[model samples]
Target: MSKAKKVIFVIVEGPTDEDALSSVLKQIFSSAEVHFHVIHGDITTEDAITANNAKSYVAKRIAAEMKKYAYKESDILQIVHLIDTDGAFIPDNLVKTRTEKGIQYFEDHIETGEVKYIQERNQKKSSVVASLCSTGKMKSSIPYSIYYFSRNMEHVLHNVATELTDDQKVELADAFADRYEENPMDFVAFIESEEVAVPGGYTQTWTFIREGTNSLNRHSNLRILFEQENLKSTD
Candidate 1:
C-alpha cells in the first residue's frame, strides 16, 4: 500500500503574498517527493477588504480551525507566518509574546509548528514601492519587482511610466535621493542585497514545507517557493 503522505501547514498574511511566492515554489519542487498542504488565512471578500478586516479576519479563522483539530506536537507538520514591522514601536518583550502566541495558536490546531517572521526595517523603499501600486502606477505598465529597474541605482526611477521632459526626470531623481538620503546606485544595492519579503512569501510556505521535509536543504528561494500546489481545506 502507498504510505500516508505527511502534511505541512503554512499560514501567511494575505492573498497577494500567496500568488507571488507560491507560483515559483510549485514549479521548482514538484519533482521532489511528498505532497504539500497549505491553509490560506487571507480574506478575499470585498467586505473584508473595505472594512480593513483582513488581518484579524484571517487570524481568527485560523485560530478556530486549530481549536477544532486535535493536532499534536509530535506530528511532522510545519507552520510559517509572516509579520510586518509597522512603526508601532512594539517592545521586544511584546514582540516575543505575540510571536509565541502565534506559534501556540497553530500548534494547538496542527502538529509541529515552525513559525518564522520577516520584519520590515527599510521604511523608505517599502513606502515608495507600496505607494506606486496603491496610486495605480502598477496598472500603467510598471511591473512590481524591484529587479525590473536599475538594480544599482538609488533613485526610484522617477516616473516608471510615460515620457518625461529632461528637466522633469532630473527633478524626480533628485526628489528620490533627497527623500532617501542616499545615492540611487547605493540604494539599489542595499535593497537588492537585503532579505526581502518574497512576492508571495506567506502563501508559499507549504511549498517550502514539502521540499524541506523531503530534502536535505532549507533555502527559502522566492522563485522556488511560489510554485507549490494550491491550498487545501484545513477542515
Candidate 2:
C-alpha cells in the first residue's frame, strides 16, 4: 500500500486569516489532493516583540511547531506568511538589520523548507479588509468609511451568528461592492499580496538595513526552494 499523500501547509498570520484563506483555497483546490495547514503562533505580540531575544525565542518556538509536520522532501509545500503589527518603537535601522539576519538564517537553514515573512507597518487596517471580504455581503449594506465599514461588518456577523448561510453571506458581500465599488475578491487578494510584499518594502523604505538583509536572505532561500519544488510538479 502507498503512503497517504501529504498536504501543503500554508501558514498565515492568525486564526481568522487562516479561516478566510482556507475557505478560498478549499473551494479552489477542492479536487486537488494537497491539504493546507495554517499555523497561528501561540505567542502574543508583546512576547514576540519585547527585544531581540524575545523575537528569536518566538521564531524558534514557531519553527519547532512547524518541524512536527515536516513531510518527505517531495511531499511538503512549505509556505508560511507572517503578518506583524509590532510597530511600537520601530526604528528605521532595526528593520533593516532584522531583514538581513532573516535572510542569512534562511540561507543557513534551507533544508527546513520555505518560509515567508511579512512585517506590515499597517497590518491592522489591512487585516480588517481581508476579514470583511471573506464574508459575502450586499452592495447597499456596506458602509462608506473603511474603518466604519469593517466595524459594522463585525457587528453584523456577530449578530447573525450561525444563521448566516454561504449564499446569504455572499449577498452581504455585494454591499461592499456598492459601498466601495471594488470587487471583494480583488480587495482580499490585494491585501494578501501586500502582506507578501512586506520584505521588498523593507529594503526600499525601512530603517534597519541589516535586519532587512537577513529577512531577504531567508525569503530568497524559501521562495526558491518551495517554488522550485512546485515547478517540478506543475511543469
Candidate 3:
C-alpha cells in the first residue's frame, strides 16, 4: 500500500470534536495523513486575541505544532480548522440579558448576566472568524480552510441543543465516530445533504452563515472541501 503523501493537520477545539469527525475525514482524505490536534479551548476567543492578530496567532499555533513534530513546510499538505459558530456573528442587540453570572447559548440569542462582555466577545470572535475565513491560505504560506458547526458540535451532530457534560460529550462523540468509521461515505452523504449543508461554494457559504440567526443554526460547508479536492483530482 502507498503511504499518504503529505500531512493534513486538523485543529479542533476539544477532544470530542476530534472523536466525532476525525475518522470520517481520514477516510475522505485518504491520500493525505489526517492528524487531529485537540486545542481544549476556542482559539478565536482566547485572551488578548483580537481580529487584528487572529491570523498571526493561528499561524503561530500551526508553526509550534509543526516544530514540535519537526515537520517542515514541505511535509504539510494543508491545514483544516474545525470550530463551533456560537452565534458570534449576530448583532449586539440580540445578546439578551439574564440574572445568572454565566452565559447560555441558544439558537437565536445568547443569555448572559454580563451582556456587554458577550457583545465584546462576539465582536472579537466574529472578527477573528472573518479574518481566518477571508482567504484559503494562512499567513504561514500553507493551504488552509475552516468549517463550523453552529451552536456547537453536539447540537449539529447529536441533535442536542442543550450543553452536555463532559461525560455525555465523550459518549456521544464515540458513538458518532463508531457509526461513521465503517462507512465514511455515508457520513459524507449526510454532510452534503441539504438539511444541514449550506448552499453555495466556499466563500459564498461563509457569507450566507453570517446573516441573522443562521450562524446559530445547524449548518455546515464541509462539503466544499470534498468538491475542491475532487476538482483537484480531475485536474
What is the overall TM-score of model 1 with all chains considered together? 0.26
Backbone clashes under 3 angstroms, per model: 21, 45, 0
lDDT scores in order = 0.30, 0.32, 0.83
Please give the lDDT score at residue 226 for candidate 1. Answer: 32
Q: For model 1, how does the per-residue alpha-carbon lDDT over 40-115 read when each residue is reduced to its tens digit?
A: 3322222334224443443455446444554323221333333221211222222223423322211012111231
Root-mean-square deviation of every model? 19.7, 17.2, 2.6
Models 1 onward score TM values of 0.26, 0.33, 0.92
Query: How would the candidate models be sorted by TM-score, starting from the highest?
Result: 3, 2, 1
Tell me the TM-score of model 2: 0.33
lDDT of 2 by residue, 140-229 (tens): 221111111111121222222122445665565444334333343453343334222222332222222123223222111111222233
lDDT for predicted candidate 3 compared with the true structure: 0.83
Q: In model 3, what is the error at residue 29, expressed in angstroms?
A: 1.6
Cα lDDT, model 3, residue 191? 82
